[model samples]
Target: MFDYADLLTYVLLVLKRAKLPQHENTRQVLRLVHEAAAEQNVPVRLASDLSQKNPFYALLAESSLIQALEIFAKGAHRCA
Candidate 1:
């Protein structure tokens, strides 16, 4: 499974510099991506180039992103 926690700090840093809404926006973006990907199969083996792959990478990424988004969103935002 692709873990977003490992990527969170880097992503947050970019968001911070961009002055983007942090947690809430992250959740929204993740959710939108997840919904968009519902029809396509996720590739299990991720390649920067096209090659043999499993079909779960996208789903896992989406789920992981959503999970990460929620953790920060609810933890940091009282309204969440």
Candidate 2:
């Protein structure tokens, strides 16, 4: 389990390592996570285990993390 900050940092690291463009959608998803964390008034680390049972997981789906990952995958594919 990790906090929102950890999640954001991981994503940033991936983007940097992959040299993927930080598209608006990616930013929006990050923003949604931030907002959700704030709204829940709980540390995301405590609230999330990256499981489907958590609110964070629902937010991930709603915010389209998979799409963001797909974008990253496409960028990596291009580089390859």
lDDT of each: 0.35, 0.41
Per-prediction TM-score, please? 0.20, 0.21
- Model 2 ranges off by over 4 Å: 1-24, 40-80
Model 2 per-residue lDDT tens digits across residues 1-80: 45554465444543444232343346544554565545544344432333212122222445565665665564432111
Q: What would the C-alpha RMSD of candidate 2 be, to one decimal place? A: 12.3
Candidate 1 lDDT (Cα, whole model)?
A: 0.35
Candidate 1 lDDT by residue in tens digits, 36-80 = 346443332221111112112223443666665665564432111
